[model samples]
Target: MENEQIKTIFEKEGITSEIQCPKAFEISEKYGVSKMEIARYCNKNNIKIRACQLGCFK
Candidate 1:
């Protein structure tokens, strides 16, 4: 989803009220994996990820 568009949806759900989801890092940690592992896996899978750089979830 477009970042801004996602933010609005999150706000309605009382998540950020300004931004979408706290951040990717926070999400990854919950999955029991380092952020680096996530990046590497994404690359290996040919997902074309260019570093999460979100620094929001982890």
Candidate 2:
């Protein structure tokens, strides 16, 4: 998915700076995108994903 699309989803879902475990899984399932991909995107864009198993951005 495009970065703008991803950002839109995050914004629509109220996932601003941080995404918790449940929200992460929810977005993964809801958007048909993997948790790793979301985590990676957030990490690359300087957003924080709390308590993710993939260890987002330190």
Candidate 3:
């Protein structure tokens, strides 16, 4: 999915924080997107990530 599409998904799904969102697994499951892709988008978009079990940022 495109970055804007991912952001739209985030907004539509009410996902405001990675800490609360759990490595965006919900997005992965709901949208059939990989966490790695979401991580890339998050990183490129300057979105703050915290408590990621997958350590996508690190």
Candidate 4:
């Protein structure tokens, strides 16, 4: 998906600056994107990952 689309999804999901780990994985699966890609996008956009299941993010 495009960046705009992802942004829209984020907005719809109430993700402004932070997102839960499960939600991120859900988005990844729903959009057919990799978890690493989602992590990269979050990192690049200054969006923090919270409640990480695997302790990947803090």
Candidate 5:
């Protein structure tokens, strides 16, 4: 998906500065995107990932 589309979804979901790991996974599955892609987007956009189940983001 395009970055703008993801941004819209994020806005709709109220994901501004941060998002939980499970919530990210839900967005990934719901949008047919990879978790890594989401991570990259978050990183590029300065959005923090919190409560990572795998301790990857922390």
Candidate 6:
């Protein structure tokens, strides 16, 4: 992940700070949504960081 791109993802998501072990599933699961939904969201937003990208779909 490029430095600027990482910054952009956080700022775009209104999460402008450091977070820890922050898996997308944590947010989606609480909404009764599929983890894959988060993956798609990231893709749509152009946040291509591999750690955030996932293979959670069946």
Show how many residue pairs clash in every candidate, following the order shown: 7, 0, 0, 0, 0, 0
Whole-structure CA lDDT of model 3: 0.72
Best by lDDT: 5
Flag the better candidate by lDDT, 4 or 5: 5
Clashing pairs for predicted structure model 1, backbone only: 23-56, 23-57, 24-57, 25-57, 25-58, 26-57, 26-58
Candidate 4: Cα lDDT at 55? 73
* CA lDDT, every model vs. true structure: 0.40, 0.78, 0.72, 0.82, 0.85, 0.45
On residues 1-58, what C-alpha lDDT tens digit does candidate 4 reach at each position? 5667778888888899999899998988887867777777788789999889977554
Model 6 global lDDT (CA atoms, 0 to 1): 0.45
Off by over 4 Å in 6: 1-22, 48-58
Model 6, TM vs. native: 0.42
In Å, residue 54's CA in model 4 sits off its true spot by: 1.8
Model 3 weakest lDDT span, ten residues long: 14-23
What TM-scores do the predictions have? 0.39, 0.77, 0.72, 0.77, 0.84, 0.42
Off by over 4 Å in 2: 53-58
Tell me, by TM-score, which candidate is best: 5
**Tens digit of lDDT per residue, candidate 6, span 12-41?**
646433222254455444444455554454
Error of 2 at 44 (Å): 1.5
After TM-score superposition, what is the CA distance of residue 41 in candidate 2 from its true location, in Å? 1.2
Clashing pairs in 6: none
- lDDT (0-100) at residue 41 of candidate 6? 48
- Candidate closer to the true structure by lDDT (higher is better), 1 or 4: 4
For model 5, the superposed segments whose C-alpha errors exceed 4 Å read 56-58
Question: What is the C-alpha lDDT profile of model 2 across 1-58, one tens digit per residue?
Answer: 7677788899999887888877888888899877767867787788877775655324
Model 1: ten consecutive residues of lowest lDDT: 15-24
lDDT of 1 by residue, 1-58 (tens): 3334433433444443222233335534554445555444434434343233555223
Query: Quick one: ranking by TM-score, best first?
Result: 5, 2, 4, 3, 6, 1
